[model samples]
Target: MNKDQVKGVGEQIKGKVNEALGKATHNPGKELKGDLQQAAGKVQKAYGDAKENAKDNVKRNAR
Candidate 1:
């Protein structure tokens, strides 16, 4: 996977943990932040996936 994909996955996992921790601590703000981070990570991962697919297509067409 590309850097963005890897990073995004990592961020998503981290965000999940953060969200869980916030829930355990009864912190709504933290939970919200974590949710936002998770969403951003998902977007980043999607972007990486699209980029990778485009690259593969270009290579295939070149050959």
Candidate 2:
């Protein structure tokens, strides 16, 4: 996968860990931060997916 995709997945995993930790520790702020991070990661991953799709489409059309 591309850098963005890899980074996005990493962020998602990190966010999940943070969220679980927050829950276990009863920290609402940390949980919310984790939620936001997860959302950002999802968006980034989607962008990477779109980029890859577009690249493939371009290659297909060129052929």
Superpose all Cα atoms of candidate 1 onto the true structure and report the RMSD in Å to 1 decimal. Answer: 0.6
Tell me the tens digit of each residue's lDDT in model 1 across 1-63. 899999899889988988998999999988988898899899999999999999999999998
| Model 2 local distance difference test score | 0.88
Which candidate ranks first by lDDT, i.e. highest? Answer: 1
Q: Give TM-scores for every candidate, taking all chains together and pairing residue i with residue i.
A: 0.95, 0.95
Segments of candidate 1 deviating more than 4 angstroms: none
Whole-model lDDT, candidate 1?
Answer: 0.92
Candidate 2, 1-63: lDDT as tens digits: 677788888889889988998999999988988898899899888888888888899999998
TM-score of 2: 0.95
**Each model's total of backbone clashes:** 0, 0
